[model samples]
Target: MLENPVLADLATDLPQAVRLQRLAAHLRARFRCGAVALLQLEADHLRPVAVDGLVPEALGRRFAVSQHPRLAAILARGEVTCFHHDSQLPDPYDGLLDTLVGEPLPVHDCMGTRLEVDGKPWGVLTLDALQTGTFGEDARAALAGYRVLAEAAVRISRLEREVQALRTTPPLRAGDDERGAVGGDADQEIVGQSAPLLRLLHELDVVAASDLPVLLLGETGVGKELFARRLHRQSPRRSKPLVHVNCAALPESLAESELFGHVRGAFSGAVTDRPGRFEAADGGTLFLDEVGELPLPVQAKLLRTLQNGEIQRLGADRPRRVHVRVIAATNRNLREQVTAGAFRADLYHRLSVYPVPIPPLRERGNDVLLIAGRFLELNRARLGLRSLRLSSAAQEALRRYAWPGNIRELEHVISRAALKALSRSGVNRADIVTLEPALLDLESNTAVPPAAAGATPARPPAPPPPAGETGTAPGPLRDVVDACQRAHISAALGRCQGNWAQAARMLEVDASNLHKLARRLGLK
Candidate 1:
């Protein structure tokens, strides 16, 4: 019975996170359900705290009470709420299940029980099964019996959190953070659980509460904008507006007016007096994407606003004070720009009060799959496919390939492969579609061969050195970088029997300046 295991867990001094995850997994096993999720109620949405069988992105999703009728129905009652297989209301887990068959889930039995802690709504426990009629009266009663244990688990988890908070003053837990919020969109959520991602999220959570000007530093397509929004959400100004400005997309002629507003006749396009992004984001966050791309003149004006929380309209007589928090992002090296006199030094210091470096996708091991699951579901729904899954080879291919384009590149790869899989060999949309390595279109351009997609190197490869000293990659940002980052350049050299020129050729470089570019990437 769950009584023994649940009671034993309560007795053990387990960490709060471990306890909740165990509870979800145990419940799924107990009921023999296809999936189990424990969702905590945060304001108006249900956020998954622990999930046993849902997609990786499932944890990142927030189900608004108004949007998800089944969840709302479950939360409305104290007892177990069973949605029979035939119920018409939508199931949010549709097309997101990772089953043994992995076919599209047709009719399924699903049930959930609402949980409360200290007289407040805490969360809900949900179970789903592939077979219809899997949830009978007995199952309902069993879930009802388990509800008490679930609530106890949550209550104890809460107490543990309070205790831990007093000890460490912790950041928002990953499962509870709404970088997933997403504005209620699942795609916007920060979707990974790697140590790098968790560490970054924790740092962001702590920094978000402050009024400091946060600068997000990362490669292109690292979702810096999403992190900026998360900082806004975690800050005191969440209820206020979050205005996003793409400095790179703005014209140099109009950049100043666009950011600081303009009086009529200030420029050709200026028609009337208007407030700029600072005014729009007053009492909230103003995200400056590609801030390095801002014109030098505009950067000076931005620095003024950052110094005094005020914005002066172009052609206006005086500056008006505004209370706005700035969160800036850039893929460019502002320090180098400062030294080169292209970017202002004072502006760079003002924006980078707290710089958070988001790690690249390759460094976030196994997180690639979780992110792939998200895109897979999106494509599945978009393509009207019953199911879309990665073959083991395709998944390995995804992992081994150096994702220089980062998340954006991965999105394109998945979308293109989904389409290719649909058109190739007359694969039916009604059937389960498994994407193979060839469909991914990665190996030809990437260093990893399709034949050895998942193979491990025989020995521990030496740390990669600079790329310029070795060879120049004739390949498009691959061969050299991918070999260095994913595989080892020394291993390539080893394969060439310690021949530098041969290794350079194998890495697809010019073999002249192969070992320097990596130093630019902080690799020694």
Candidate 2:
């Protein structure tokens, strides 16, 4: 009747994101279901704009309609689409329901209804339950009846955005087809809404309007390349090619020729004339990744190109004008490099006109959960598991640990953890898997979230040298040492059930030190 608390918030001036989130939560509560997801159709994919009873990373997922038959069937129908238990179509969220812990159980019921706003197809609202008959005739009628209210909620949220966009940004031209919470390549979207990330996005938006050379400074694996892509896509030259070059990957001998084309026979392998990255990116942007790795000789030429908007091919007679915008990025401290004389001072100054320091994963607060959710989905799909989620303890371990490797490290950790969790015999893809701190295998010490350092589990003392394994008189010293190191690490790993961090503690050494030693002993 639109009088309930669920629909009341639609009239409130809540932020569009908050409003959609609340709508999903209310829908879950109202339906008494396991999870509720509001997916916005972007191109051919269904992106979850808001979700309740889902692991945090679900927001980062983009479900292709072609892959999820249930979603596709729902999208095709104006009426409520119900997939009762035993329906042949696989549920898009097999093991993703937040309620399923330990092992995955088959989801019993799922139903969805299409949402339309302003006479146009909007998206869809889906509800899932772990119990059969949850979406019976009454439930189906209720969903269909509430469909209008759901559509209204979306309509209200959309209008709010349109109004704001009208005030701050230009109107979307006709046929731009820009509607809903979806746009851009789904893979390219940044996931979190943390204050620091929001602030950075705002700053990037401002900088993207100009043609200034931007230097992205951050630790490795912090997604510097992703940020550069976002900047280029946001800029005026979005339609033009955004050429990427890894200065560090370029061979020292070919570095100049790579960045500034080469004439025929410029070098031994240069059989024909070729355009460099800058020329390839003409009328657009050239992304120079690991810019600090550029050799000193190349730095001078790069400085000239940035200043004069011109590049000369190696062995060419003269330089020619080329309109290109430079967006350079590096993990190294350019200022320190300049001070140390490894990088040219003038080039450093020119490139850092607008330096953007990308914050590491640890700084983004609960964003870790959101990002982890994304990874969880990916792992779930990859491992063919019905559901994969982090146990509360595992999530705490993630939050506590310093992400030295940043997002790259996080991706590796999640992927590895999923595999380890699934390594158990008889674990089925239909079974839900919960990742505990043990499975995460994070450095027990480093993975401990900040302020929780004392929470690390203490190891049992070194077991009295294994009841007779005293420093023995073995053969060659190097041979003996290697054999002993390998055996000891192996025994520790076995006792700890293959947890390296746990084994490190049992050995009474730092986890990193243990890793290095293991590698040296061929025990890793």
Listed per model in order, the count of residue pairs whose N, CA or C atoms clash below 3 Å is 18, 11
Model 2 residue runs over 4 Å out of place are: 1-8, 100-106, 117-120, 162-183, 444-524
lDDT (Cα, tens digit) per residue for candidate 1, span 107-128: 3778998999998889899998
270 in model 1: Cα distance from truth in Å? Answer: 2.6
Q: Candidate 2's residue-wise lDDT over 320-422, tens digit each?
A: 7999999999766667557667779999999999999998788998788878877777777777776677777787888887775577667777987799888
Model 2 accuracy (lDDT, Cα): 0.76
TM-scores of the candidates are 0.71, 0.80
In candidate 1, position 22 carries an lDDT of: 88
Candidate 1 C-alpha error for residue 158, in Å: 5.1
Residue 511 Cα positional deviation in candidate 1, in Å, after optimal superposition: 33
